[model samples]
Target: MDFTSEKKEAENNKNTTNGNNPQEIVDSSSQLSVADGNNSISKEADEFRERQARDLKAGLHPLKSKFVFWYTRRTPGVRNQTSYEDNIKKIVDFSTVEGFWVCYCHLARPSSLPIPTDLHLFKEGIRPLWEDSANCNGGKWIIRFKKVVSGRFWEDLVLALVGDQLDYGENICGAVLSIRFNEDILSVWNRNASDNQAVMALRDSIKRHLKLPHSYVMEYKPHNASLRDNSSYRNTWLRG
Candidate 1:
């Protein structure tokens, strides 16, 4: 709740509704147990969160997995002489909930991001591309929400993921969110395209965390198909 240092630093860039401190964007929606306060974190949550309080008192919070966040934006009437990967920026990697918040707080929010921009948070060392070995055998579950409502869903999904609340073990690769001109899209990526049990569990976890009914529909797509057709967002496969 206190970002005095961030407030002072962001004062010069005070263009956002939160008055320049990007950290404020997550205040209403931060789902990380470390951010949600002690009482709100149930004992059944991930072990990372179980230890977050003690770690925080010692100025550190360790997590079971590491994640890297990336950002990219498309510009109109601008032909950049650089590869798409070259344009993509690797924001930072976090091995703890607190560290994740520190990096995320300074980044632009999905609602305020430029049109045609994506926010990718993947397991450390795994590039957010289908071609990566870690993702080649994986697929993502795409969910759609209005731009204004997507932020909260995005928050919960990321927390459930990094916190290992999905109970999928290491099968989860990462998640991505696309902020487009029309609507927003959020996807949960897992390392397996054929593990029905694990995949179903992840799907159900997502639904439960977002408090959606079992009938709330979403589609799963394999990276192999994307590689075959050179598409990223296309979901020809479906899984309930």
Candidate 2:
């Protein structure tokens, strides 16, 4: 329809592609480039050693342990936002142990990011949006965290997801942190909404790892429900 509009929207994505600024240096990849000129040999050896150590520490299925990182700014409707699909492809292309940490280091924490924006990390081949074939018929188990408690909760949740701690880890498509003024929300998407067994398993896994108190409650809602009316889902699932 509007090719010009799409072109302008694509240009706005410059910052997204140029990610990893203000480097946090969390992985060997970032360090390798710095070993320029004379010290390249030593740097290569050090990097090799670091990689071996990482491989040793990697738990079962090291390859699957890797997660893709996606960032969004606090903007309405993601309107005027960067090319999301393109950015996701970029992530998949560059995904590696080093790239994951580098991307994380550069991006703002969910709590620190402006409102309405989100940071999503899903297994490779899985898009963050619910529309992906992997997610189309699925749903998410959402846990709400107050703004004051969001930072550590977010970190723990990320670790839990990437570390493959969820009960139905294979069913887990990805996780999302939706920022809001009052309370931040974390939703772990599963591949099938109708799979009661898998859904229950995932919910229990989250509660166990997160160690939610007896007073706390988690809600599961279908993506279709979310798209139709988030409030209806919340009301039916949430209890005081």
Candidate 3:
């Protein structure tokens, strides 16, 4: 999952698919911005549309839905919404396969990201915030993995998401990769916590796509529980 190899492969694929020079791909990292509340979301949506239009003209294959990448460096002891909002920064938004690779190639690998850092990939217009209307009634399924395998798992999850490999993809809102001191955690967010069938289907789909071993335990926690406890990874229901 290193950038050099992935970039080369993507470049080759682009050349084969549309006969366009790889140089046409823009570096999306330069577009990173910190959200200034509601206004930022509105502005981002407009920008996303404009960018997608240009990419379409370039012959890139469009994805079913657009997605935004977000990064945040947590303050060790701070857990409030105000502080969290301040730390989160929007990296870029992509609506096509080529755009996704352009963004992904520039991102630091999950294993290399510093402790207390989080990388989020969410559907466009859906902020990663639990308070977002799209997420308020939802929950997430989290899987913890050793640091060494973080990159592979994160990439697999991203591919499955954008490729629409999941049966319950409509229920999915986004995903997060948290790099911590000892382990990396991956969480997939859904739009409805009350939809048991959809939630379980999402979990199954994730396991299948990731080829997750049965030995690994998965935990599900409602956003309401996180709001009450002010913790993202506490008091969860576990499935082995």
Candidate 4:
């Protein structure tokens, strides 16, 4: 079975809508004041993002956090690729929006990647491993999509994550995009799994940011569960 043909057919489905809109995610609440320093922070977050966008507009873009991008691919005939960690390579670290876009433009999009490839965009200090101390207590929210829409979905979510539009308030660690044969899974990792409030907030924010309908489903899985399974991509526990 030539999955690439299936991928092309999937791309033609056109279920993915145009969602690169920032205003759709960040609302007028972004204008609220932070007088007591405890007021609604959606405004502050919006302000911060506006500033960042302005910086990017002026060719001076910088983000609140530094992020490292990693790439992993399974080679068909390469004996050098032994383990998941073996094929993984740290690509580049970007702190600015311009810098990220430069890399993004040069790299292949999710739809262009071969099956079994994965991309990791984690905070500079945190590796994308589930066992990493920074992620040990955290969990991931997985959004699965068909190849047709997954590429756009991945890009929009990455922008939101880096822009801090999700507004989980620093509870987020980073995000991962896993490309597979039948589908692609985009998951956001946070710092605390037990923090149900934070998890749900982030989940809802993702749905809102992507402007997804109520019927869409997002899956949550703890890092601890991944440890026992030995593979982040399959066979573990699922929390709604």
Q: TM-scores across all candidates?
A: 0.72, 0.65, 0.80, 0.70
Q: Against the true structure, candidate 4 has what lDDT?
A: 0.70
Sliding window of 10 residues with minimal summed lDDT for model 3: 17-26
Compute the lDDT of residue 52 as modeled in candidate 4: 79
Number of backbone collisions per candidate: 0, 0, 0, 1
Q: Model 4 — which ten-residue stretch has the worst lDDT? A: 24-33
lDDT of 1 by residue, 1-240 (tens): 232344353444323322222232233433321345564335335655655665777776567777888766656444343555666666667676556556565565677777787788888778887777778888988887888888888877777777777768588888989887788988888899999888888887788888865655788889899778766677559856
Ranking of models by lDDT: 3, 1, 4, 2
lDDT agreement with native, every candidate: 0.70, 0.62, 0.79, 0.70
User: Could you give candidate 4's per-residue lDDT for residues 58-167 as a string of tens digits?
Assistant: 76557787787777775544433146657667766666655555444445567666777778888777887777778999988888888898888887887787777886
Native-referenced Cα lDDT, model 1: 0.70
Considering every candidate listed, which one attains the maximal lDDT?
Answer: 3
Give Cα distance to truth, residue 171, candidate 1, Å: 0.3
Cα lDDT over the full model 2 = 0.62
lDDT of 3 by residue, 1-240 (tens): 222334666644442322111121223333322456688768866776887787779987677788988888888877779989987877777777766776666566676666788889999889999999899999999999998988899999998887778878889999999888989999999999999999888888888989998888889999999999888998886564
lDDT per residue, candidate 2, 22-133, as tens digits?
2221222332113374596476457656655676576311334446766544444443214544433223322233343434444555555667656677876677765687
Our tally of clashes for model 1 stands at: 0
